[model samples]
Target: MNCQTLLIDDAPAVRLQGAAGDTVTVLLRGAQVISWVDASGVERLYCSPASPLKGPQAVRGGVPVIFPQFAARGSLMRHGWARMRGWTLQPWDTSAPEPSVSLQLHNAVGDDPQWPHACVCTLTVSLLPNGLRMALTVENTGPASFSFHAALHTYLAVGDVAQTTLAGVLPEGAVLSLREPIDQIFEAVTGPLQLHSPLGLLRLEHAGFGDVVVWNPGPDAGLADLPPLGHTAFACVEAAAVMQPVALAPGAHWQGSQTLLSGL
Candidate 1:
């Protein structure tokens, strides 16, 4: 079957199976992608073994969609409420011949008291033979203009932390190598980027998104959601609009996308 529904931690989840044996699993709890693998059964994304299964909190790994805010940079709670709430699974479009699914989040109006803006968000995930595509659209439904930041926090598994390299050079004219734990937001960049790691090479293409956040809580840092030495297993290269948020006028929507290709 190309599409299948199942339960994860008593939460609704969908599995989108692509033609070339690629498979992607997403949870309705946060409309977060928890697992992704290529046709050869080689896992592409990282889902922390210590990530909480059920949550009013963010999962430690995978593609966690951050919306309306990027961390504590706004009035909203850390990373906003998108990853902490469950999303509605939408019906598949018959016209699209590919294996795909859409998720919606619109209850932020009354539920969020900190910010008083009505909005609707739609996230579409499409599985491909060699990679995966994700699209996000956020519309302002309120009368006033609203501004917000967003990100696709992706945790990629690697063979070793010290050995991995972010293929693109920094805006300052130098490439970045993870020598210690890294946690920094990069300047806006254009075009595609490559990630060279021990496990494999990954190509990340950004569209309508400019900022990137490269993070890994080095060995010195400790997080409750991760296991001992878990930081060594994965590195996050996220697509985000953290440096500058998008401002939307009433009835207007902001859309962006990111593509991940495995073993390139």
Candidate 2:
């Protein structure tokens, strides 16, 4: 494992790299992955330069950690508090099988008025020859059972959103009609999925999470926080638990991952 430190808005970040030239960059703020580049030096994840580099505000792109809640459908605010707060870097064994770094978030570290649950979240980023992988493990530390949704909210770059196709249950390379904005969640999917993009072919594979979320905020999304014209550069194809929240008893834990690999 290889680790390097850099700064974004004076906030410390870590970069992990593999022998094949695969790289993953993570910011300590929210433990958010700001970049992922495969061998050959092609950026695989999309993080708009317009996005907020410093938080308490969520960065508008890349693989942001969404934990304890997936969206506004909960008592907490939209997408929960994990993405908006800072995280601590943990001591990682560089001798691990892959280039990896881990970040952790625990309730004692901060205060969120609406969410009072005691929990711990661990996010690990790694580099492999053909893919960039992320694993999120959440543990319930409270005395009672609690349920929540989580996702690796990934914003993938595309040359033209209208030219992208998410290969799915449809046949003969049936296209995912991009004529309109897409904001939908797919549940109970079994395995890997391939997304054909203007950038390249992106393959997403996950386990422990059963729902797949795809979203594209067209010109009419009207989100005041979104960067101007930011919607045009990427598509969100995520690994999530949105259809149903995962329930964890006291001391119990759950884990999920999303691996992205691209080929031109």
Candidate 3:
């Protein structure tokens, strides 16, 4: 296992390499996992090249940590402030069998005034053989209770979005194929999901999340952060708890995770 600090577009980032040639790169800006390469050197996550790497803006792709809120459903900023705030890197065990790193956010002070709450959030990314696992834990340290929603907004790389098929615990032989724009939230997702694309087979498993969000903007969405035809190369399959907000009392904590297995 090896770890190195590198800069992407002048922003500080950490790259963790496993002995098997798999690697994961995490950015300090949002504690985002921007890249994941399998042992065969194939990138498994899609990150937009046109997205801004610096500042108060979130990166366009990769696994974005959505916290406190989801979308425009709250009074706070869309997706909350965790994805825009810088996080401090936590020390990890270098002697571990697999490469792993953790980043933490102490949201006690200097957070959004509208959502006043003292909380701590940590994101840990661990590299596996031809796979990656991300875990998010949130702890409330204030005297009052608070409710919030969160998700691991994961963007999966594909050879072509039109040629991809996603399968869950659906009707027999029924799978989702993205040929047009789609933004659907699935509730009570208790089973694993399989994504079959031209690149290969990938499996997604989630824990402590009740919902799964499948999204693709198609070709005409015209997102400023994405290049033209960029929509053809990726799909968003997120593990989320959005419909039901989680309430944590003072001194309470909660955790959720999403794992991705490539070439499976």
Candidate 4:
């Protein structure tokens, strides 16, 4: 059965129930978190919401939604034009044994004049027995070559953000920004990520990524968008992105993935 039926006429931000009794919802304005359920007992992944190229604001948490190219310096926006454009549910696969689904967002019409790359992108969310899996695949449909970074931007829910730590990161020479001014970016985190606050301990591993960004927006930091968490409910251990730009060939295909494990 097509899972689209479960989401057929529902508003992008409204919640709906699946045929198998599962649940799904959309955040209209944010078009993020396309699908969600409570099978394993709690919400696992927050899909969509592109992560910014660098950042001015970069949304606090809950998948900022990514697109065309990540971290591309331009007048248009931080991350290309994908997250800013409205995506349609093209080919959804909710029948998989793992209860998976895929949504297609293409920029053939060159939605944003600034980002003139014709491309077809797919966002997939697959549910596993233990947790959830999210993957992004981009295929260049244009003649010109281009490249960008893609990140899941997961904000794992924790009992407390100040109490957690991140493992599996470069220990030295890692670049990071401070909570208050954030006026300038610094390089540090020379090794793995480890969080030892009041919350808990967390670990993140990156294969294709170069640096791990461990961000915990404290009360002192001014944030525009904050996820649904207690005062400091979530912590971000994002897979490091390309500090340098990636070059893509015409018709080139690129993919990025990140996984979050709890109870560590």
Off by over 4 Å in 2: 169-174, 222-227
Instruction: Give the per-residue lDDT digits (tens) of candidate 3, residues 130-186.
Output: 799999999998999999999999999988999998999456657988777899998
The candidate scoring highest on lDDT is 3
Q: What TM-score does model 2 achieve against the real structure? A: 0.92
- Comparing candidate 1 with candidate 3, which one achieves the higher lDDT? 3
| Local distance difference test values of all predictions, in order | 0.84, 0.82, 0.90, 0.50
The best-first sequence of candidates by TM-score reads: 3, 1, 2, 4
lDDT of candidate 4 over 1-264, digit per residue (tens) = 324433323334434344445554444333355444544344533321342322233334455455544454446566655555555664544456665556667776356676677777776555444344566677888899876655555555555554444433433433232222212111333344444444333334334445454555566554434433323665555553446545578878776655433335
Candidate 2 per-residue lDDT, tens place, 1-264, comes to 567889877768988888886788899988899888888787877887755677657888888898878888888878988887888899977677877899998884237667767899999888877888899999988887878899999988876777777875244545575446899887886557788766788888998888988889998877666766768778898899988899999999999999887763
Error of 1 at 6 (Å): 0.5
lDDT ranking, best first:
3, 1, 2, 4
Q: What's the CA error at residue 102 for candidate 4, in Å? A: 0.9
| TM-scores for every predicted model | 0.95, 0.92, 0.97, 0.69
Q: Which candidate is the best by TM-score?
A: 3
Clash pairs, model 1 backbone: 181-218
RMSD of 4: 6.3
